[model samples]
Target: MTKFDEQYRDLVFRAIVDGERVVDRTGVGTRKLFGETMRFNLQEEFPAPTLKKLFFESAKKEMFWIYQDQSNDVRLLREKYGVKVWDEWEQKDGTIGHAYGYIIEKHKQIDKLIQGLKENPHGRRHIISLWDIEELPYMSLQPCAFQTIWSVNRGKLNCQLVQRSGDLGLGVPFNTAQYAILVHMVAQCAGLEVGELLHTITDAHVYDNHVEPLKEMLFRPIMRDVKPQLHITNRTQNFYDFLPNDIRLLGYDSHPQIKLEVAV
Candidate 1:
């Protein structure tokens, strides 16, 4: 089982306040373009908050919906998981172009990424691009302005996420957890072990509307008992063969939920 600490939360808080203050006082949004830098060495610890219950299955399903579907239609997500977070972005034709799911649905890309890991394990350039600038006009929120790079070294998989803008308090937590799981999934499929996750955000700002809620979270004490453990079965070479139950998280404990607003 893995327990997340307050170090990331505190660092992100500072980055958001400082970045937002700079943009407010200087009228320059560049600070938002260049986000904050943070890293999580999974080898040292798994980064799930000890304060609130983090749902691992939900995170895994969401990731499956995005990269696996090749369609960003919220209805599909709702059908499988009953989540409508992207309902507003649904198109009239009942299709949402290569949002996150679209890329995963592509056969060539997935094969290439897997092959890259096996052939070039030490290369940091093993990246899976979700946001295509050319397709931005068709997207709803453009899948977090971040790009992800995943690599493997000495049988350990490492992941790095580079973001142009981030709503640190709300988005970062989910993004971090979900992507961390993604790294786990990829590593499992690639026959490798989990390593570290390095998250770097450019404009890591807590939305103006979420400031108070964040303050409230900071005041509450973290629940230290809940630990996260990953369970993966079916040692198959094909990533697509992985089912929902193939990977599981056991014994996750946390405090009450904290509500926060999103900038969208």
Candidate 2:
């Protein structure tokens, strides 16, 4: 019934009835589509998926791993956040080099983005790119949601997230929430209210192994009408000073967690 659930269900339904069968990097082939878009207005809702029990803590922690810690080390994620989602992509040296955090840290885009949002809100160049062409070979996995472009309209921050690939059952839900939160964080730092979040995925797909669970998720009813709220108590303008404790999710009443295997 909420925007998050509607968009999510629509995508799942698309994969079910219209998606084409195809081979992918993981031997677990997928029902694929070329492009799709979903939009969420921060003014209306925070856009947390209300239909399924999303790991809100893990989503926030992963965002912290990407932006706060600026780390590619999966071990640190496990140690700090109790999340092992990146363990498969991590190597012996404990890195997924130049993947997500590496790009932000390397270019210092986060700093520039906030500065640009303040100095030049409509610059048309406030962007962060995660896909590093030269460093691709060194990375254990290529960036999925590779780019994020930001803008300000009517003194409110807006974001357009472009993801090159998305796994419907697992990745998209978390990515959507994390990036929406990213928009909020940036807005708070830049002294602006939040606006719309535009998410565009180029290769959206559902893995073969996750079909059954995906179907089950589609059938489950959303438990409540109230959407989750993201509360950022950090008063500092400095983005790096934001500890995970600064952000919290409130009133996230939803259905049970849906177990679906990640395709490696």
Candidate 3:
């Protein structure tokens, strides 16, 4: 297994055996760990989890919604791409406030970040943030993978994401697959080779109800011999030009899907 897979498994196993139990927002209780980090070298292979199948289609749609569409409309995702994970977070007015894509749209974070990559590759200001303090109360949920900081070195693009919280069973894998796809897309558009993706989580936890499903994943053999490959069919240099059909996961081998109830 890749270190990405190994560390993910290790973290899950760690939570089962070593994490401290605490009641959380969902009231499901969680066996949680404080802080951890995992590195995935994009040059090596695509860092997709093989112990369990990833919903790459939905992940891609969600990522596209967050980055390209710059939207807070989960209804469109549900009707168009069958991505309903964010339905619970959608308010009655059909918006999640100035969180995530809403903030990106308002601030033009991705556009400016990509522009910086092309104009000033060495600039340290190439960052996109979704956590807006002013909009926190208006949002249904605070951002998790809140910020993305990009750096270009030697014609290769690297990215780091700081997530405030991670749900080990339900949210982690989707975030992993989606963000990895994003780095590849952005790198391709920016005409840089893929470098590495560093993911850091402040609070990583497995909910009580999710523990058993995670255990089943642990028992399965992870496709460790080789990692999957990502493909971008579009050669469009413009980051905003990417369509859902543009991204594809090739030769992604994995175990059967494991179902887990979402805490919220």
Candidate 4:
């Protein structure tokens, strides 16, 4: 079976239905339509997409643009990955304050997170928060309510992602894979084996325009042979030491691409 199969799909489906029902019946117009919780046992599988072709190149480029490049110029993203979603966020100085790369470089947040992991591997409070509430006013698109927590238990690394809002069509797929990779990388640096990834979304919603495509997914059969595996080439203690070549995904199989409208 794929990393995400019937079980995962069912849970998400149920949550969406319940949320929609609540909104329809209670007149709570603000009630969410698609919120879900997912837990991946790392020992069992590396949760990458196997039922559909996941654009690893795009994923890597986006990650690099956000966490590695210290610039917020959406032009770079457009040039490299054809992603110009941040065009409006660009500053006159050829930078954007809200860009992930800008934040990482400006505050050294990733380094701080790594230090926290090394100093207190067993601490329950290990977290790296990307969305700075104070900086929201400066953002082109305020951080979309994403938070990640990493912890160690008996030499295994566990990660939990809490998202207040999820654009399932365009964002969830990439978000899931990126965080999983983050967990893998952190675990490698900490000399710990990757354990589990728990994903919880408070207001996960499929855009109204994506409903038809999702219905199609329910009827389409999943490719059972595709399995995703992560190959890490470096075993360095420094998280920053990791290079693009150091990590790779293997044995991935999936269906044709499905497109959905992004509710920006």
| Model 3 spans > 4 angstroms off | none
lDDT to native, each model: 0.66, 0.87, 0.86, 0.68
At residue 254, candidate 3 shows an lDDT of 81
TM-score of 2: 0.97
Candidate that scores best on lDDT: 2
Q: Could you tell me which 10 consecutive residues in candidate 4 have the lowest summed lDDT?
A: 22-31
User: Which residue window of length 10 is worst by lDDT in model 1?
Assistant: 24-33
Residue 109 Cα positional deviation in candidate 1, in Å, after optimal superposition: 2.5
Our model 1 lands, by Cα RMSD against the true structure, at: 3.6
Between candidates 2 and 4, the one scoring higher on TM-score is 2
RMSD of each: 3.6, 1.1, 1.2, 3.8
**Model 1: per-residue Cα lDDT at residue 71:** 54
Q: Which segments of model 1 are wrong by more than 4 Å?
A: 1-3, 15-17, 22-34, 104-107
